[model samples]
Target: MAYPFKEILQRFWGYTSFRDLQEDIIESVYLKKDTLGLMPTGGGKSITFQVPALAMDGICIVVTPLIALMKDQVHNLLKKGIKAAAIYSGMRREEIAITLDNCIYGNYKFLYLSPERLETELFLSKLAHLNVSFITVDEAHCISQWGYDFRPSYLNVGNIRKLKPNCPVLALTATATLLVVDDIQEKLGFSKKNVFRKSFKRENLAYKVEYSENKFNRLVELLVQHSGSGIVYVRNRKMTKELAEFLTRNEIPASFYHAGLDSFVKDKRQKAWTENKSRIMVSTNAFGMGIDKPDVRIVVHFDIPDSPEAYFQEAGRAGRDGEPATALLLYSKTDVSNLKKSFTNAFPEKRFIRTVYHHLMNYLQVAIEDGIGRTFDFELGKFCKAFALNVVQANNALNILERSGLIQNTDTRENNSRLYFLAGKEELFGFQNQRQEYEELIKTILRSYSGLFSSYVYISEQTIAGRTGLSNEQVYQYLVNLDKAGLVKYIPQKKTPTITLLKDRVPENIITISKSIYEEQQERMKRRVDAMLYYISSDIICRSQILLAYFGEKKSKPCKICDICTSNGQQKDLSGSIRKAVLDKLNRTGSTNINELIRDLTYDKEKSMEVIRFMADNGDILLEDKQIKINS
Candidate 1:
């Protein structure tokens, strides 16, 4: 039977056709086969699952690592009248329970969950009860160590097969190397027969690199020359703010985006940029995922990214509408040093990792097996002050721990709320009955949550404490005691996001810096920088050919519209007459001062400088200070 995907596509998303590779990926998943999708950033990845899920009978579960993206996708689906929901780190227990129940019994077609949620018994058990048709892992490259952004939570996805032995898996990413692709397939348990990939080539984007002493002025010139909307990517949050301010002061309509901004501000700025209310956005890497703006004409990288994967993904954000667009990178020699510093900052010393791990375990007051589903309020500065560890070292250790998968880290800006049953309730409660104190808490929860017996509801702990006339501490103690009893669930209200380390402690002997890994990363970084430099320095190759080759494609000729190709024909006329005069002078004298050479030839100082610069750039002549030598 045909999956009726075409009909579903029109009925739901109102698209008359599938964008390239969407149909193939959808067909693969619909047949209960595994797939690896390598579509570029704006290539309609969501439709690959959304259309197929509508045709299937059971729920399609999407595992995403980004909380903001989860919410955005869920909201979009909900607006389209599709039954969709998400469970993320900051949600209350009742909220999660209700969303899960909706998936089990309601007409929900898609359910989204954070990768970190997969480790919980509560989630795993409830997930087993749901009739899930398929599992889609977004940003699938994160499962591989070779990927630019590797998350430890992504590693836990291999266990999903244990829960649903036969569910087809679909892995998706915008950018992945051969190593990352292989790692994703192996980690996700996809059979060789099931793997699928699209080529990583964007033909319409014109790649150019300008080699000038002043890149900032070059950027301003390009922005003024370009017609449509644009994006400028910087490596740090501080640069995002500063560059956006600088452009605004210069009267360009621009805004800045980064993770440090409040959600409300970020959302407002993002919307303004998306809707074209703002012509350009200056941002850190935080700005691009799930963004659907199709007419971005230019994408400029002010600083080099650490790897090619990150560079491709960020640059791919441009030219989605398919009209001619430019991807430019402004890199200097210092960018390499900056990138090395960033890598070191991202992975700290193993001793620091162990210290942070112990501190977290002590703060939570629980052993390894007992801490699942428990939430803790974490303040990094306070922890650093108490432990006497450098803040940078502590933060890096926390990052490594999170990567190791010992805990769930919630990094959202919203404050989370904690809830537990006033007394134990029986029917809704499943799992975690192993402890006795939890049984009493479940009893208390049952009596307390009257509405929970029938349906999910949010109740404030203060209200329960008020009714019981217990002090806040006593209420919390009883809740913790009940949580230990497994009768009532307790969720701690998180004011800030916590970073969960994958390991309780770093191994003493483990090498954080290996020569091989360092060399490999250095090579990847060098490729990106070289590509940028090639765009700036190459005069013979077509700008398009250079760019296409970087993404693993080969084009035969230059794009006629690029500055070099367009100027080539006219350049001969201007250079022919000047070349004759220069050659005659060179024949008369072996070498001469540039001023004397120009004066003898009657060329203006500006024209003399231009000719020398071009010759030096193209390697036809060598210049050292005022002296010039013709190449033999």
Candidate 2:
């Protein structure tokens, strides 16, 4: 029963012990049992599968929804000398083929692919050939329409059980409600007895909400006062850019990131922020999925998120290094209105969905059956123009279609080529000798790469362009020409996450409403608003205690560092008689001013206010203007 996990840990990652539930998860996988991991952000979720993959007999297949996360995890695994490879949209075809071939030949221990990519014949065929030990689905809540970040592709995970019936499945996510947890198990086809859940709580983060008319100004003051890396999340791309600009104008080194940015630019900005070249990043929800920057001191939400699940996940990103961190939300009545507007925008009418569905089919020039394995470039504006549909309606329809799973949208900057040499060193040298014009380029590539001969490599075309003094386009074309000349094989890269809708374009009348989906989204929003209100109104509970309880954890005492616990010196727990006296004055006097109430009660002003607040919190008093009234 003994394994070399400890040796594997020390030899590769230089770690000695497992974090929280990682060892338990690894053990479960080893025992061929299903597991559901609910570790918080920065809890080392990656190691749960990684250690097990190394210890198991066959390759582990990880299905993730984020392309950025897949690439980052694969890169880190390779750095540790683990045989891991990821098949994502931005990779060239030859690279994918080589990686798939490696899996088929048992040369890789872990294979990461997008859940959307599971339907492809090429991937499925090769996957059938490989002996997969277990399947791990990250962000498992996305499978349920009730989840905050629902995706239709996640529904295909159940089919993995059909493909490899003997293999167990592990579902992992940071946030999920009781209902979401149930749906994930059902949707992923896990047996009832196999599910395992860890507590979802972090004790180090202090959560608080500030109510103010001028939230931006408040944010600036807080940023200037707080020292360390921070993130400010806005709801839209425009706000992300504007807030970052405002912060920079105020002399805070800041950057902005969103899905709308070009990949290269997004990569650069993310690198700058992660490396501490920028201390702050104002971003939309798209920014933090795969990022693991540990020492974040604060997380501010300029606008409320759509649901509590999202809010908890984003807030959990703070204080990951276990030092005390602050989670602040600047709340205004307008944020609630804006959030309602967003919900309407996300869920459109059925006619609109059909219109956009037809447009997409026509734009791609494919029939229903033929579209399953097809991939195409998508232009939102062009498609809208062609159908004479409003841009918002058209975009929302496409999103619905993507959620349903019909077509794959490969959105990227432009078409580009990449090369992966197929020959051994001696054969490559022979080819280079015959093709003398390309000798410098070949040598440059070889010098820049570390394991070019034995492993599948990711050479930066930008670096090759720099060394050869050629435009990126020129370098790409040269690589394609070399492939045609049989010097090396090449494939064009795809840049977007492959999106496939499960059903073809159906009529508006045929679309069925899932009450669970609607109710779930509504409840999610309610939970977030409740959390915001809780942080602002609570007086006796510690800020950290409130947050931890929301995430399903209990703490016996306050953390002492939070605003409530720290202010204990200035305040005392009022006696029940004093609380009743405060309520009685409010009820008898009816709308009297605060100063008059203090005088009438014959109590000090500070203690009187504290008693009034305590009565209000206990639902024994209602405050209006400066006066308080007892509940009827």
| Candidate with best TM-score | 2
Which 10-residue span in candidate 2 carries the lowest summed lDDT? 410-419
Show model 1 residue runs off by greater than 4 Å: 211-216, 358-373, 385-393, 414-495, 501-632
* Residues 200-286, model 1: lDDT tens digits: 656677666555557677778889998789999997889888888888888888999987676556777898998999998999888
The C-alpha stretches of model 2 lying farther than 4 A from their native spots are: 89-97, 192-198, 367-370, 408-418, 431-437, 450-457, 466-474, 492-632
Give the C-alpha miss distance for residue 190 in model 2, angstroms.
3.4
Clashes of 2: 7
- The number of residue pairs in model 1 that clash at the backbone is 29
- Residue 143 in model 1: lDDT: 86
Whole-model Cα lDDT per candidate? 0.71, 0.73
